[model samples]
Target: MSTDLSSTPPGSPGAPASDKLDRHVLVIAGVVVLGAIMSILDITVVSVALETFQREFDATTAQVAWTMTAYTLALASVIPLTGWASDRFGTKRLYLIAIVLFSAGSALCAAATSLEMLVAFRVVQGLGGGMLVPLGMTILTRAAGPERLGRVMAVMGVPMLLGPIFGPILGGALIDNASWHWIFLINVPIGVATIVYAAIVLPKDDVEPSETFDWLGMVLLSPGLAAFLYGVSTIPETGTILDAEVLVPAIIGLLLIAAFVPWALSRRNAHPLVDLRLFQNFTLTIAVIAMALFAMAFFGASLLFPLYFQQVRGEGALDAGLLLAPQGLGAMLVMPLAGVLTDRIGPGKIVLVGVAVITVGMGMFATLDAETSYYFLTGALFVMGLGMGATMMPIMTAALQTLRGHTVARGSTLLNIVQQVAASIGTAIFSVLLTNGVKNEADPTALALGEIEDESQLRAFLEQTGIPAEQLPTILRDLTDDLAGVFSGTFWIAAAMVAVVLVPAFFLPRKPPAEPVDQTALMGH
Candidate 1:
């Protein structure tokens, strides 16, 4: 992996780009898409399967959460370095290797019998998975060039746009009909096929051996990011910020990132892990910030929604996925139009409208209670889907509008790193809030009146509190109805976070694209 890798020539690895590429390009695109599909599915597939995992492993919620956290942390940490890896190793080589690694990790995860081993396997998968998106973008950039970027991105968005939707559905179906292990087993064949195909098709770019890497920058940047992400993921979401589990690591991580900023900025020349100077481009900086906030707010809802549907509202996994499908479908419906809108009207107006719509959708969700009808929830999800579709593509397109071909992949990688980090943090924050909300909403009076102390005792008391022994079940139903108010408060917090995204959105430049910037320049020391 440390070997010096110069890029291949501009043409196909073994033949002319014009003729050799047509068939080969499809193979390359399939491989790239395959890689992305594997990663994307894992992100959401775990949602439905988490219950199965807990039952099989006899785990607690906090322990099980690590399964999700482990993969995301590893993925977020490695995304920053993808540009350098691709530049050094070439896209085809890196893509094939990543796929094989991911497939191997998938098999290991399926076979794991212990919680620790499963989490560790996911980390391996994440490391390989992290490299796929950027390299996939690189493959497209190399094969299609800027003229075809719009069409290429639009087509490529299919898997990314649908990953969240399909993941839950697949997980639900597999877990219900077969076993949780199948969720992972599904990736194996796809990865192997992709590896074989990419080895044959992906174009190799001419590598300039003259480019120097900032080794010091990577050392500082990677750990700082990993620590920050780990800390964010560990926020004992049910506890307060000052809770030892939440505050200690978070403070340490924050300090590290604080240290990273000054360290990177001081490096005056050569490649940096993240080129700090890229922020000098106002739109690019704004775009990056937008992506972070977008991820934080959006992914936050993702955690809450499923839980609300399944645990609170009592829907099954497949039903939850079916319920959530509107969001993905709506995004797919609007993506192409978003591409055209960005090309025509600039990102500002589109983003403003999208943000507004998302706020409205989330706001409606905030109003939900345990009693809120499922029909209303579905409507809100669709609106969220629309708003998400309307602007994110435009923002991503706008972010890279000024970047060069080779640099586009790198810039996108940086954007993805920030977005993933924000997502992990967002999930953590939401978890904390949800836990607090549930605890707070549990009536102190009811708790005091009941003689039970532990959760089991409280559950038993609540089960028969008002009962003439035979009527206990009916009384418990009444208690559940009364608890509706508590869940609504959780919705309020979720809505508030979504609304907060509007703040950063106000400053997005309405201006058109100027000169195209070099994407590689953003990789800083």
Candidate 2:
């Protein structure tokens, strides 16, 4: 039986009452999309501005990086609290509060006088931003009902996917035309409008009877996730997982997380922090497995795209961001159709096709070299985008469709945690691979260029390395070609991971259930 009674039954749990999303649901989706845009865009926009922050604060690379890391750590720590908080306090009230916190944090960030102050403000921003996605999913899922979940999710997916592609372009334009503060300041007005819109438009959700707070699970999971992600985030900079900075926290984090699993599985805690019980749904379990594989392979390889444009082709940050637009365009073109097809046939058939398309696109990237044509590269990206638009949201729909009542919130939260963790691990793994590749191929002169910030340091660094100054031009040219090979090889690895997603995807529900399964009945097993 369905637990959430917010919306009247359409036709059946698995079938839509109507083919189109009604006006009320559309309004709710709009509010969710607005909040999502602010949260998702901030991650990438701030990333593009890291160099600017470094120069402005006169900080070392490691110190400046904390601006990004602190935000991420804060995000990982707070996400576990969202599903519980939404159930304890109503979703609308919590949604508005999150906006206020995010907005206030953004304002404080803009006014910060030092790097430490900026990092502190970012933590506040992260706490608010972390809740937006899962909460948004809960709000939309409850309002749209199961029949239209795919389409509404597709609408939400647009900003989620586009944020990474467009954030750098927006960040670069603002940095060049304005100042670094604009990135943070940009969120203020949007946040204000979202608050007002949500306050007026979103239907009030009743707070469910609160369950006993999972204090032990929170202690185990929050720090475990924060410590784990902090370590993973450092891997790209440290260039190896073996480093003390990476190993110590990562190992400790893993052990703590391992402890959390059994504790959550125990029968004593009726309401666990993350609700691992939802995995009892076979369709949801397979969907998340496929999602993890896809996220690792696709998002991991995506990190290299801008680097390829900027470092190898020598495009400016703005130009590199612009060059990647075709991928976003391709995703936009296909997502709505994919959503429709998922609602009709089931996510299984569509996902298999999506994975195949992504593999083809990735295969094209795997062959890349320094002299590869831009037309061919853009075409490949467009093809991949089409696949991505089809793939990501459908997987989410597959995980969420069967769960009833509060289980919807639990399912969304679990799906998000898996995606975030998988993407982080994948990024770290691929980054280390590429870094090693470049290091192995480059000589002392090539490595020195990365270390030297100014002309004064260049001569001294060359003297220290004992490389002839006369060969600099030739070394730069050769290093560029070497970088291309390293990236190509890494893309091949990413392509293989994408292919692995198919194994789990093969088990996703092949057709929408003629009737919704009783999720309550499955929870006992």
Candidate 3:
């Protein structure tokens, strides 16, 4: 049963002739990429604006933080329903509706007069924003079919990888020159345009209204994810996972997620909101695990980089963001080549090489000091970007290659969920480590300076510490050195974390078949 090479998709063995995506597939991919960029950029852009929001709204740090927290919670809550919604409403229609909702939320956010109102509107935006990426992946998967998934994912990954790199720079520019409201308002036109274009060109897949909605699964999974993420988000602020604020919700969320697995597995005919059975595929399972580890390492290191630039190097937000651009540029340069190579050589070997590169990049970062050259840092970051660009999309493509038909949507959602959780855990763990490292090395007197706002209070604190006013500069210098050392150690931890990916990468299939094998035939379709 030999399959025609021309008919086979790109990832499958035996079909070199069908490697290039059709023009129609390219157009669809372009549209999906547009929405993905808009949504992901929106997430990262708001991060740089948080301080501005706090001051403008006259709110406490915790209160102003809710602007982001609420949005994240909403996103976590809604992601589980995306698979069912896509099936019930059709991918094209649901995608259009999501855009409209996101645009409406953006408009409302721009018009918000109070922090509370802004937080409310952000939740609305999250509802729509959460659906866009998964649905976009689902749509692209079906359109490109299994064979071309690697190339299609590479295209879609452009915004996902670049959004964080450029988001802060854009946000800083907007805040410095214009009002913060523009951050939310900017999404309006993009969303509207995407909606209109998607409505016109997107294929209308048949709606499966008969597909049973797993209400129990939703109740269990959505809140579980939200609570877990919320707890993790609190770690930077609370300083420890043992805090009641972190522990209670995280435990409950874990219990709920654990419960959902068996409940979902026990279901007979109806599909769970996210199918656990997909984990049965060894390749998909390993890919998912690799992705989770990669997310933790990548995101944790990403957080540390900006803070090191800002706090230790004394750079502003925009400068730090620009400095981060080399990594993204590196990723951009390599992604197309990585995609093509993954198709030809299989993902396992590419991933092994990519992870090795990333580990080397992290090792470079781990050796940084306050006086590290800008050129060296830039080159290292670019290498990290190259490694990430080569690694992430291929892992995603590998997972998708193993899925077919209805399973694709659930698989996308599952991957997104794991990524979100992994990033949160990474952020939480690294944040705690950084905080403790700085505290352990910092001078007690210098640390107390942070709390002394008034000149009189500062003098009183200095007198209490029995330090002369003239010696403050020396203490500050020592403090900077300590911070640099702490950040350097943190990068080492990130490197070690990234090294863990090699274990799972080895599990990925080493080579593609020389001849095209019909994916449908292999899957017993």
Candidate maximizing TM-score: 2
Q: Which candidate is the best by lDDT?
A: 2
- For each candidate in the order shown, give its overall lDDT on alpha carbons: 0.71, 0.88, 0.85
lDDT per residue for candidate 1 within 1-525, as digits (tens), equals 111112324453322233222554566567677788888888888877776778889999878888988888788778878877777777777787788889999999999999999999999999999888877876775665443343345556667767877789989888888888999998898888877777766665566563467676677677777777766767754366666766676677677667667665675645556656667767778888887888887776677777777655767779878888888887888767764454444567778788888888888887877678878988898898888876565666666665765566667787777777787777777778776765666554443433344777656665665534565455445445544555566667666776666666666655544446654454432
Per-residue CA lDDT of candidate 2, range 231-289, in tens?
99899999998899999999989989999999988988778899888777788899999
**Of models 1 and 3, which has the larger lDDT?**
3
| Best of the two (1, 3) by TM-score | 3
- As for model 3, its CA RMSD to the true structure in angstroms is 3.2
Total backbone collisions for each predicted model = 9, 1, 6
Query: What's every prediction's RMSD, in angstroms?
Result: 6.9, 3.4, 3.2
> Which regions of candidate 3 fall more than 4 Å away from where they truly are?
1-17, 450-466, 513-525
Q: Please, what are the lDDT tens digits per residue for candidate 3 over residues 1-525?
A: 323345557554445436687788888987898888878888889999988988899988888889888887898789889988888888998899889888999999999999989999999999998999999999998887666677888898899899989999999999899989999889898987898789878997787555888988988999999988998899999998889999999999999999899987774625788877777777889999999999998886788889999888889999999999999999999898887766666788889999999999999999998889999999999999999888999999888877766778888998988887898899889999999998898777676764466999987787788878898788778777888899999899999999999999998866653332233344342
Assess every candidate by TM-score.
Answer: 0.85, 0.95, 0.94
Model 1 pairs in collision:
7-207, 8-205, 237-432, 272-524, 272-525, 273-524, 274-524, 275-524, 402-517
